[model samples]
Target: MKKTNLSFIKPLAFAIATVGLMAGCGSDDSNSSSSAATSTVVDSEDNQLAFDATAYTTVNISLDGVTMAVRQYRIVYVANPIEMASQSAFGSTMLLDDPYIYQTMIVSVAEASVSDENTALYFKVNNAGWFTSAVATDITEGAEFVSTSDTDAVGAALKAGYVFIDVGTRSRGARAVDGSWAGKAPAPVVDAKAAIRYLRLNDALMPGSAERIVVTGTSGGGGLTAAVSASGNSADYLPFLAAVGAAGVTGEDDSLASTINDDVFAAVAYCPINNLGNADAGYEWQYNGIRSDDNTGSLNGVAYSAGVQPAASAAIAALFPDYLNSLNLTLDDSSALTDATMNSAIVEQLKEELERQLAAGTDVPDYGEDFSVTLRGTTYAIANDWLTLSGSGTSATVADIDFEKFLKFVTTPIALKTVVAFDAVGVTGNPNISGETNLFGSDSYEYANFTQWSWNNNEVLGDGSGTDDTGLAWSDYLASTSELATQLKLINPIAYLNTDADSAPYWYVRHGMIDRDTAYAMQLTLYYAIKNDKSVRDVSFKMPYLTPHSGNYDVQEAFSWIKTKLDAGI
Candidate 1:
């Protein structure tokens, strides 16, 4: 609920306007801002970097019978472009999975001047299962065109002069022919930061201000979005940036090139499946005793085994309380998060979500009827009698929510993931081989244990038969226990909160209430951490009722939130 700094916006906007006017009037022809646009710099010994102000295609974007012309620029942001270029060699024969892995696209409304307060930058990094690279396509290929009677979020932003930048980055399975990992921990985030720096160094040629970039994504991409937002300008990324030969890797403080050192203005995350180090424990803590089965793969509603899984799950669940206590997170009133108040906080959040759904006139089955809601043509159902609504449509509030009953109704009948969800020790019969396992791997194909609990107790945690280690030994895991811990800290957003890193000032996080991908504890932890940070200007956290693990469900509303911030010049 932190308010935007209206007092700080006016002068900043005036200054930007004045700068733009001066640039347009040829008042500062010799200024570094003007010179940087046309100048070239050596990114490495072999490649030189420059931004062509005139190199772009004008595309007519039509949404809701309204069309707007925007210029789109597709540029390779890496220093050694040929290394990751199209059909480039990875491992002898394995070609580059995504041709545009090192590229970026900037779309902005056609304008006379480059600098404008109304034109903010939206940077999007794509990730699915942590292994699938973001598919980079031309906007002219009808990629941005979706049929809708009302304007969409991207369309609205474009019309309002917001520059949208889609960044293509390396993901979990990318590797070099030199037998080294190309896309591993720190690579994706490093690529994203490099893209930001590329835009900043070429800010004079771009239509939006580099200082007002907003990064957004969903699921694994959402996790990366949060990482990009949290670790901005931190010294931890210096080596990685230098390795990629990113633009403006070094510069004086507050200089044009120093904008690389600046942080994003805001961030938007939906169902961010991050914080992998604590994810397993958090997942088990919520759904440990809920399911009566031992099936690790599909949610068949058949109680498989009553032996080892329940014990291992309980063991993992027991670790969550201490982890929660260790974070020292605070509630809205600044009270510490502990075992004593966790359930109450969760119940309150659920009630809030239900209240908002009621006010929106969302349809729900009768209180005595089974709980069933369809999303994206898939009807998710559960036996129910726990929720009760008061008042009529648009005025209804959550009369009561049977916490235990609701928990059973949502998670039961369907298990989102296995006991050890994120850091699945793959050796056992349990197919814990998730994308996160590849994410923490040393290379593209190798999966490693990223959590201490899973690593130490892998023998018993896997198979759920209270048996011996039947597959690959835990000691032979790729990353050592300490190394995995370090990587986890590097990717976790909570680690950067209240730290010296220039974390994004504005944040909008949405986790669907019925999302079973990751535990609600993960988002709740991030929400509380951001809410407690004094440096953050504003943070809006919400869980839409009965929504799935998706992003931009309320596209119009999300864009409106971004528009309000842009109008405020923040």
Candidate 2:
């Protein structure tokens, strides 16, 4: 998808206008000492590498008679010089290099204010691998990515003395690629903190010009914000280097917590996927509806399962090669099984051997009778069971339970097992134990809590068993669906706000009660959760009726709310 190019006034013009508004609003009380206190920029090469100097342009947006020379920093992909220049010529031939291999831009707003004065700093990070230039590309054919509503919201924020910062970090569209998240936390998090640090180090770009700041994002960007805020530790260079596979910086230790001018005062998230490790129960029903559109269960009535399965399998298979290489196993030796197909077979054989070893009270020898005995008991046993029940057919059936079990066993134990092993060997860190730990625990089964309006309430959404009886059974199963929950959670702003509340920065959350994307129901759930949480005092939620996800009503309402917040310094 291609994003529409939005041409707004030049940065210099916006900045001059902003300054004029500030000047007219009140006297510039920027004391020399106050300026000096916040003016120091750390002279570190890594910091420099993370900063995009060229992306900085002056904007002069008029606000309430003040024309401020706002420094507008944009995070854009700095495509490889060779590849960029040859785009038209080399199109498909260009290396599919990672989109995150570029610097980030952070805009800081500086203004003078009294002790009781309220100044707001706005930080906006794009979701996933999206770049500023690729905003239009992120939208679907009928969907708007950054709608006019979004632009108006930003404009209103500025007029209210809110210094808006855009962290043109990596875009979210890149997640569509295969193996993007294999063996790593998404790359956008690193970019997020870098953007935050840049803003802290340079406060001259803000309007209210106070150290207080708020963070906000939607979808994958919301997840990134939540992760950073929830983690609650300062950003350390070593961890950042480890995450991005960059060379470690020596003798430089900066914590992200301290680098923030102050704690993130508040956070606002829009449909954030808080936990990717587990599927969401509420989303499964919606997904099942999508899947049931055709006789054969599939996304968009297409055979997407095949594409999805292989990519996942391939990612799991990658772990074997990585582990073998780490163990110094040669390709020609026993490790030659590292080939995905061969590796899968070897994994099956190993499982059999291990089971035999466990049964025999001794370690099973290589490729021998004991191994075969176990293999026959396991693999053949399943194949035989399928044969006994129903003769082989094209459709999967209950008689194929043994076959399904065997496949799942091999996939999870071998393929998934290797991923866990690699993570242990590579990252060498304990699992994070903090807020909402184990929300998606292994024992947490999912069930769909269907609303009264679901289409599938009377008919099965897909080819799955069970009549479309709108009872607890169906509702439970649908609520337990993970795929829909994954997508919905990705867009839930309330989830982001909850994650951000841990940080000190305040964020304003606005949701349309009737939005289908970020379901009105889900928004209410999150709102109550935040309102009830004792830890989150700075966050606020606003619900407007007669609005969808990206409608004019939502935009205008959000703009008004942002204006009120910035003006009140709440």
Candidate 3:
């Protein structure tokens, strides 16, 4: 087990201080020194663009008049008032539903009461691992905050005076309105970038500063947020963005006065389920200690749970160190941590989560917990043939044993996915598997999701690897690999953390330690990369103990962080 040699990551000491949390968290903003010295918060003016944030009481954009409603808009940097805003036109699912017809983004400016011209645009999207197919064609009408109350994050942002823009992006589950498989991997990512471009291009007409646009999302959307942050100003989405009428698309040669850029100021992702390529290995390593067995923690009364095809799990876990070693990582102290030790950081994160949840009064069932009960019907386990009773009551203490066994007692087995996981080794397409594979699926929405597995295994036709072009194998593999590499880089934030790709310097990442959906290592790799990158001054990432694959524990804390960044103009 080699160590992850990154000199920028925070040490356990930092974690200790963070776990203890600062008093008046909303007011105490000194926890993360990195954010205080964030690099992007410069005093230099960026005049390359030809727009400025102003106010608009009417709709400012329309897709052949596709939008059915208008969220909010403003006018600035323009001598004439522009009005054509409609919300229903921004299409998702399939970009090519019409030759020039595509999705529209519900642009929001500050509320009618807000007069701050320095306010910034905030994009909020949470489609999760699955794609969201809305209920109405005129989705713009839905962006308005009518009778319904805003959620935690949304409400917090509104109170902070942010102009929230809810984007309508296609996801893996998106099917063409014409019943075709058009919305695929690149579609959602492409649309996401396009939405940002729309905000930036029409900056003069929006209420807030487009240059300071902030983005937030959860799960897969969180992954998208990270990717967009990393892929800022990347040329990869230009062709698609142009086709979607995002940047200065007026008619033929005619166009609107816009920047045509998709850059953002900051990003926040919650349990971003990304880095799919190495997820299996991360999963195996995470659950390596626990054995597979019925509830009592006994294998034929031997006081030990069996492993999950131990050999297979080990084979996958063994690959993790190599991947970790390949990353050019560093720690905050400028010291190198081997991949093995870096992995231990993840384990500690898990332990911290368990303790956190327990303290929160959450019913955390773990071996470390003192109280236990004689759970009936093989529910509780007796470790080392011992169960400690807690004085008089029916409650008992969980039999102390190996930590792995205790984790297993709490989480059961990690059988949610297949042994090979997302790539589907022998399977022809994403339809072969139920989840992530499908998210990567394309072409027919039923197949075409195999990227990494095919690149390694599929013998490209006459290449003499014992595979042939019986079903377009060679052609399919080539196209699949191209899409795979491109989309993987486009969506996986981990893929560009060290690259020159323009990205959001300020980031707030949250991953639930108890989330076994994918390996926590995938998330930590980003943390390690950011901490190691001296160029970035602001980043706050954490795992809520025992939390599921979700977040929003302290929206006010995030708001506080964002407030500081906003004040600093980062």
Candidate 4:
């Protein structure tokens, strides 16, 4: 991203105050108490939110009739905690008289000695669609809602015996009761870090070991999971985090409550919606290969069928190889990955895992070479259209074909897929649609083309007929070469991998094979990135059969994996 010239603008006095807070939060600074009292950031009304000394407390609560001790507190994660805090359980309605709500954090923690291994923390968010984080009770209980289901992925973690912590971080659509951008980019992630610090700061009295916390989330929450896992305690986020009054500065040895580390021991991201900038190209590779004529067919190939205009699909397909090679991925054993090799390795290894699980009666389906298989009235195949099975019931052999031929054979496929880059459709149709478009858009702007494809189509390409396509006004800020460029780097786990900052020592990534909201390649790249890192070894991942854009298909399996990692103490 281009750096702006700040010479023209006048500095706010609040800026100086921020610096003083930073100084107080410095590694060697031990006067946090006085600094916190003297140096505070004020909001629009000149109101300063201070820390409440007794807000952190534990109580006994019963869920499902199981009585357990739960430690719950609301932290003013940022300096200008928003107004919503006033209405919360721990916040005071009196502004300036007590800490404000904008930057406040409500964290809930419970011990699971019988089910938990060591000190593990699973981060929970309500971002099933990566659009909203509204409180609900099930994955699909309400429209575009999640973290509501007690029987989903979250249940597995609870059953696995790990201390759980839920951070009340804000999201894109999160509006303060005062109608401010309280929760925005870097806000949720920043708040999450603060909550982690709070846990570590009180680890001695807390139920679990702070050293072994494991972060977990689904969809957009999973996206944040990747970001948080990769960018743990990075200096880049210090400005935003410190601004929010988060506890635990690196250098400061402060009041027992103030300074602590903010990284986790491991992370589990289920169907993480990430790698946005390049996700479209990967989606194009998967969808464009199917001939448009194949639409509405039984697709003797796979459970779901897909197709778009042949020329359009091919045009999109042409963009894939170059985009893929740019990843520069490699194997743990020092083997460089070419596009063909990586894709081949994905297919081959998946075939083996599928076959192994099937033979073990794990309900995972089986497949053969050529990326094609036949099971229970469905003849599933990918890669090249030349060898498609002619008769449905008889044995068949799919011969070698080109890459463009292999694609999802869906009955009724939508244009650009449900998970295209930046959401090409949701904007004009559903105003509140939860898509990647919402994820990338800032609080001030509800929509922006964060990808070159979106940029070219809506601004430059103009409907592909060589005419002006006024999808949205083009702005330099929204361009990938501008602020979005830097923000993308910040949010993308890939950018933070192999960095000096803390990376989760343990990882469990479970992606659904048929999930098109984003390509399998995004998750594949993440898995390989971590797998290739010498510092990480206990990472395990799987692409489940018949699963869609959701996760946690096999709880027992996930528990077993968690137990293995816990037993190994990685």
Error of 3 at 322 (Å): 2.0
Per residue, candidate 3 scores C-alpha lDDT tens digits across 374-402 of: 32223343232212222222232222334
Q: Each model's TM-score, in the order given?
A: 0.81, 0.43, 0.65, 0.67
Which of the predicted structures, 2 or 3, would earn the higher TM-score when compared with the native?
3
Candidate 1 ranges beyond 4 A from true positions: 1-47, 66-68, 81-118, 142-151, 251-259, 294-307, 363-366, 380-383, 391-394, 412-414, 457-482
Using lDDT as the yardstick, the better of models 2 and 4 is 4
* Prediction 3 global C-alpha lDDT: 0.51
Ranking by TM-score: 1, 4, 3, 2
Span of ten consecutive residues with least summed lDDT in model 4: 1-10
Best first by lDDT, ranked: 1, 3, 4, 2
Clashes of each: 0, 90, 42, 32
The top-ranked prediction according to lDDT is 1
The sequence of per-residue lDDT tens digits that candidate 1 reaches over residues 1-570 is 111221111121221122111111121211112222333332331123345555666676564455556666666664533133222122233465534444444444544324563368878777765654543643553335443313255655555567777777776655444444456676678778877777666565557777788899899889988888987777666655655555655432232133245368899888998887788888888777665642244312323363355666787889899999998888877788876777778888988877777677776554776667666686866655788877777887777878767766766545557555777654223543453765664453345566655665555443321124324334454332344555677788888888888888889999988788888777888888888877788898888878778887777767778777766764
Highest-TM-score candidate:
1
- Model 2 Cα lDDT, one tens digit per residue, 297-342: 2322334344332233233333333322332222223343222333
> Global lDDT of each model?
0.63, 0.34, 0.51, 0.50
For model 4, how does the per-residue alpha-carbon lDDT over 312-342 read when each residue is reduced to its tens digit?
Answer: 3355556767866776778656676655776
